[model samples]
Target: MKHLLRKTTAWIAGAVMAGGLMLPALAEADTIKIALAETPSDELAAFFVALERAKANGLDYEWTAFSDEELAIQAVLSGQMDIGFGTPYAAMQRSRAPIRIIFQLSKLKFFPVTTTKYEELEDLDGEPILLHSRGGGTDSIANVIEERLGIEFGERSYVPGSSNRVAALLGGQADATIIDLSNTNKLMRSPEADRFNVLEMFEVEASDEALFANLDWIQNNEEDVQIFVDALLSTYRDMHEDPTIIRRETNPDGPIGQLPEQILGELDGFYGDAVDAGLYSKDGGGRVAANADLEWYSAAGQLEGDPSDLNIEDFWYLAPLDNAMN
Candidate 1:
């Protein structure tokens, strides 16, 4: 099967080299459009650092910060963007538009937080839950929880961020929600920590955020994609070598560098924690991560199929990351 997957990649590469794929409206020479799911902050410093590196290598790009992950996916689907930050597994399966995840930005390092009323995941049986968005990472977490714990949840509400969900929990507006690692740490350290419980969850190394685009578009703009992937791979490796490098390489005149002093102060710590948690795989999540995603999103109810039966090449065009490594 692994050998067949390689052959599939070879076929795709051959086709791309032959210019067999149709060119997208965003032509090969046009600036790449990147859809950011949220406003820039500490969470995106490393990505911005990579962008700076890509820029140094002559990759032209512009980024739009969408309201949420779903909108980001929609932007790419609508051809309003060239690439986006998200896991569009559901859209990929349902649309069949040859959308392929190129690189994984972060892993599913989220924690399920609840009030003292729930002691475990199973205890939340049929209980209302607050989440990040309709089809985003938190929603998939909820789906996986229901499947794994054999407990169906009641109402599922959408708030945008983990910090906002934390607010809802504090204001008595919500009792449970899933949040990222940094926010989870903050919540546990809060004075209201006694009021909540961070449920013990099974380890999930699936992608939480990734870069994806229509395969035709990627093939059309192979050079830019290669530069971008190379820059990202270097940044992830450098972060593992020393997380402080993100803070150091942050472009002082760019988006991440223009943040408030407090956020800037925490950038080093944020990347440090993220690297320590293995939030990014050094290979940038090609074949292994694609297979893991199939297993994960399948169990999470986002994709329909026995995981092993899924054609990984359909959901992931690993040629870019593969070439970047070589």
Candidate 2:
């Protein structure tokens, strides 16, 4: 299947060489190779729907799930993939790869969760916290919180997943941290949920996950790129207008379709909540998101320059999305 949700591999060449495992052959020259940062889930139902629409329009593609977002960015930078998923603001600034984001898949829709000891962000001024990684999205959220709220944290620890981190909280390991929408929902609904609080977060419009590609490749594959963006814009708009469309359009034979009924049952609710929360923008975040990304990423310590001084065109190619909207 082109949408191989679980298509993980030995991440590096050295790992493959050492393990002597047979890696799948690379995609054909004309095929669009997509690097997924994580396994497909209900959150990606709309994205897979867009891919299906693009395929019907003659888009040829295959996807591989990388172990993490950074690996996906590296794959695209190494020319092993044509398109990738990540908010690669740091990579775009630090590397000369000409990588430009084409679509903002989702925004920084995270929430601050803490025990009753903390009622708001200000309450954790000098408290220790847990996050996904040191330089990842959640870590950047913490950084931005400190910058915007004028408070400094005590210690930052890494725990990788929200389920695990919430357990850490249960075990009295940490009191406060940032978590995604789904995990926050799960935590707040648990038996011991009364002990936790979902802090009121300021509106964040910055991109958390986006579709990016090398400028050269994007220029060379303009037609396919337009098709892909057109499909994505259509899907995003439709989902926002009527979030249930995601579940309706999900392919029964695709990877997302193969998910267990328990998980699949949550598609409509998940996307509806996402739409209600404004996790996605109708125009795939052409200029507004790019600008917000500059401010947010700069505050998060991912991008070095002042938000106002950095050029949006340097990080985002808004033409495809603009064209799609028009």
Candidate 3:
């Protein structure tokens, strides 16, 4: 099950190693291989939905899952993976990975969970904190804390996964950590609820995850790329138009329905919980890129110009998504 969520090895060797998302005439003919992160999160589900739809539209494809976003970007840069699920906007701004965010994947809407000893972000200024990794989503949240509340965390540690980070907090090893919807929901319902406090802090703006590809590869496989992007646009429309479509599409026997038993058991309840928490959406149209432009500009210290004066198209090439949707 963990193997399924982190499918990077097989696909990287077979697809990305060969060349981009396209197959040469001498290469084995199966499907275009795409890179994905291993977990069965909403982003993965959306990609799976697009895969199914793309298949129906005659666009056959395979998938490879990486352990984390950092590796996913490396895969695309090295030409070991075609299009991975998501990459942080900061990565593009900071790294030499010749990649572009082709489509917006998802945003990190976090809930701050702290040990009961503290009540707010201000309360966490002088404390030890935990996160997924040095440059992961949770770490990005910590940066927001320094930027907004004018507080610096006393000590910092990386735990590599949000679930593990959450465990660190639960065992009284750390004061606080920013976690995703799934873990956040689980923690709130746990009997140890009395041990922590979830704070409603200022939202962090980021293009949390995005579909990225080797720009050179995408330049050559225009036709296949259009088909792939089209399917995603369709799924995007459905996902935001009605979040419940997720539950309906995720059959116990289907790709999403076939999640690890533990994660599967929580699907329906999680989906409902996510919708109520403003986690999932059905109106995800052009908002992701727009948000990404503003968010990245600010995070990169480039938001000085009026957001209205900024030309977002300079940062995004929506032709793939546009061609796909049309």
Identify the candidate with maximal TM-score.
1
**Deviation in angstroms for 213 in model 1?**
0.7
Question: Per-candidate TM vs. native?
Answer: 0.90, 0.87, 0.78
Clashing pairs in 1: none
lDDT tens per residue, model 1, 156-182: 989988889999999999998999998
Ranking by lDDT: 1, 2, 3
Residue 190, model 2: Cα distance from true site in angstroms: 3.2
After superposition, which runs of candidate 1 have C-alpha atoms over 4 Å from their true positions?
1-26
Instruction: Give the better candidate number (2 or 3) by lDDT.
Output: 2
lDDT of 2 at 31: 69
User: lDDT (0-100) at residue 320 of candidate 3?
Assistant: 80
Tens digits of lDDT, candidate 2, 1-326: 24532223322221122236443232323668899877777767899999999988878788988756888898997777889988888999998678999999998899999999989899989899998765778888889889989999989988766667888988988898888787788778889899999998888888888999988778877988999999999999888889989889999999899999987888888888888888888889889999999999999999997899999999999889889988
Candidate 1 clash figure, as a count: 0
For TM-score, candidate 1 versus 2, the one ahead is: 1
Q: Worst lDDT window (10 residues) for model 1?
A: 1-10
- What lDDT does each candidate get? 0.86, 0.84, 0.64
